[model samples]
Target: MIRKGSQILMEVLQEEGVETIFGYPGGVVIDIYDQLAKTDIRHILVRHEQGAVHAADGYARASGKVGVCLVTSGPGATNTVTGIASAYMDSIPLVVITGQVPTHLIGNDAFQEVDIVGITRPCTKHNYLVSSTAELARTVKEAFYLARSGRPGPVLVDIPKDVSNSEAEYRQLKDVKLKSYNPTYQPNIKQLRKVVELIRSAERPVVFAGGGVILSQASQELTEFARKTQIPVTTSLMGLGAFPGSDPLWLGMLGMHGTYRANMSIGACDLLVSIGVRFDDRVTGKTDVFAAQAKIVHIDIDPTSIRKNIPVAIPVVGDCKISLSQLNRLIDEIDLTDVPRKRQDWLGQIERWKGTNPLAYKQCDLIKPQFVVEKLYELTRGEAIITTEVGQNQMWAAQYYHFDRPGHFITSGGLGCMGFGLPAAIGAQVACPDKLVVDIAGDASIQMNIQEMATAVENCLPVKIVILNNNYLGMVRQWQELFYDKRYACTYMNHSPNFVKLAEAYGAVGLKATKPQEVESVLAEGLSLPQPVIMEFEVDKEENVYPMVPAGAPITEMLLA
Candidate 1:
């Protein structure tokens, strides 16, 4: 018996429990698409290759599964680069399958041919160019394994067109071993002891959780640990909802735009327990001064990330959920109820600084971005799944939106890629059909993925898109305003398309709101639509998100505008 490589690929995916795939069909990968059509696995046909990859990423982030994407070579594979890089930066598990020209056409400048392996080398955890049918099953299995394993990231498999058509005996290789790839989930006893000692001995202890908590499905463990110890917890931007934001012990995001209480708490803690967070510059601010007074205990699945940014007093390399559970069990017997409150007075003093001076805009004739977010929150009560594009809209969404559930807010936090909103909303809608799915995007970012409205209308997905129509690459403009004396060079956009017309063209409902009074009604109408809806808000151009921490400043040193 013989099997096509595409068949083998699909089998491997089924074995890995991939129920959905996001992708576009092209000449090089038509055979795979043919096989895909015959399978039970759901395939989302995106308008653009980039949208397909981001949609997969969103699916992975929202569902905590290994996202799968498929595409052809050359432009198709290249279009997925941004999305791959984005997932890599955020440590999301993604397996991308790209079709290349036939092996015989190598280096001939063949049509639709590109070296996807070379292009994705830096972005992917590992990539394989399958020249032989024998390697297809193992490579795909390894790709999935590497993708979802410790320190998860995107992995690429570039299969040639001929290879997809080639036949090979079906060999089910379970327990395939790779010598160079080893992921350990077990915590070191000595390191765990040191971390426990720190937790027991410290007067002021705080747990800084990151997206890793959600990635590891460790929220339960994280909350239990915090509750048992009565320790304060703070989260990074990507860490929102890792612990209930409304919980008494949980502090919201801690960064330049983070809540003042969260920032102050991180700065003032004597012992900082960082779980599943990489200490990104946004979270750390100035490395030298960031949690300068605190002894850090860094726990993560990726060993390389342990001391990459912040010096660790104790490094626990293991899965966040596993490590936190062990620590919680070991420290249950320690008595810390008598420890004097080291930062009680300091917290009182910082309360004035901890005031929630969130992003604000002047009374607007035009609907403002902040108002838009607030109204959306009011309508949905923050229960809906929210995705955001890059730039000012992303910041505004993060700044104004409050999430009550884990994995409700999905944004490109690490790579901060523009044009991420619409497709991500599509994926979220597909994942949870009952939840209200919205994409909060800037005019610029929205335009980049505007074509995805077709996917929504075609699928009748009922995704609500709120475009912050500032008519500028608003974030870059902010940087120019502050750093470059407001030159506003290429940041400005002009002569925009009537988004309503575009939506109508795509067979979706379209609405526009210029005034604040029109916002709630428009949002209500959009949400009620059975099919997809695009609402463009003519937002105030002058509105700016405040309390920004410049790129390298400590999270404590925020620029309040």
Candidate 2:
């Protein structure tokens, strides 16, 4: 049927089953906005362009769906880079739509025009610039297809102003096929058998899982495989919630700021079965010494990620869930009874590591951030969907709050971007209205996108914010204190604004907890309210995240506080 490009775009979005879109309007995107207003596809008008992308990213992470965002040319599109890069690093699926100048203005230094597709080329998995109305529908289809497919990442579609205003024949594409872009979903049978053999033979084996396990919905298979084999499990930060945190086999997160037992288990295990992990520097610490004693078996959807960081004895390239499923089936054929006896002593040693002060903070008059997180987790009964801003607060939330299911804990793990928590909480609240959504934020990181408080208030999202107010950029300060002779350069935020007053000004509920005793009451009251609330907790300023593997140090080497 014949339609305007804007109408066709909306039709395509509806066809893709996009119930909501986060975006802002500008000159180039006015046509799409006009059409958007007339349709039922919910559009969240964010205060900033960056928040639009971050919100979409959050929705994707929380709901396991492809997040969608829209913005205009120049600065609007440029502002999405950080969020885009964050999604790219974390492998979150997102489809970011931006409007551009008319086709003739390409590369002419036109006002409000920038080559966003070119700029985001390095960050996005793929991008497209729709030059003609005829190509608009297909480009939109390709964008969503590429965004949600294997090894998911953000994809951008730049529609020019004239193209959206022009006429086009629209057709809903039931399927999108990229001839050159096929991802292997099934692991090679030989490789799968080798992995099973290694698991059966090793005396001490450990499973290291990452975001891919969650991305592929392989948590159940992961749990089953671990339980059946009687092997302890550890997770990278992004891999939290992929395995039940309360599970007896759980070793907590592994790497810098991870549990003592998890790091030590990975260090000492004879066989390391790594799934969906990228082996990033934060997780691997010193790569040469990482899993030195283990015969590593790396399984991932992306082939490039397999041997890129650390050498592996067996590399299985396939979907995490599918690969795990294959291994489980193959494992069924083996004499699995001996596996438990073989790894029993290994689990005992891990228990000893767990006994080594897993995580603790001295009780004092001031509120410790870990204590606050624990109380929050307790008050929520581990049910609240938790998002976090970057740095110490992020680490503390990961450590103290336990997640038993996938999609419960959301954070910018790979990019470690500040200002992610607030918008992410809003997105999660929007996606799951009945769930209590909280952003555990650092004082400095919270301020970065504090403007989104208005968006939450306007939408009546009832998203809660728990700011660990130490009056400093806590994480950077800790590094300075530890590594740089306490230089304390630009890390302090002692002059920060009153968060309670700021929350009130935004027409949202605000509360404060200055003493340790007030932490429980503050969390309960803040969570009790039905509206968007910001609860600021004054925490110990000098407290640092412990069990730290100093950058470039072996993962086994730690500085415990």
Please state the error at residue 408 of candidate 1 in Å: 1.3
Count of clashes, each model: 2, 0
Quote the lDDT for 230 in model 1.
Answer: 69
| lDDT by candidate, in order shown | 0.86, 0.93
Per-residue alpha-carbon lDDT of candidate 1 for residues 1-561, written as tens digits (9 for 90 to 100): 489988988888888898999999999899999998888999989999899988988888888898899998999999999999998998889999999999999799999888889999999999999989888998999998899888899999999998888989888878767898788899897898898888777766889999888898899899988877767788887888788766767666788777777787777888999999998887888899888889999999898888998898888899999998998888877775654354455445445545555345577477778889988988988888899998888877876777766788898989998889899889888888888899998888888888899888888788899998988888888888887998999888987899998889999988999888999999998988888988999988857777688888778877777
**Which candidate should be chosen as best, given TM-score against the real structure?**
2
TM-score, model 2 to reference: 0.99
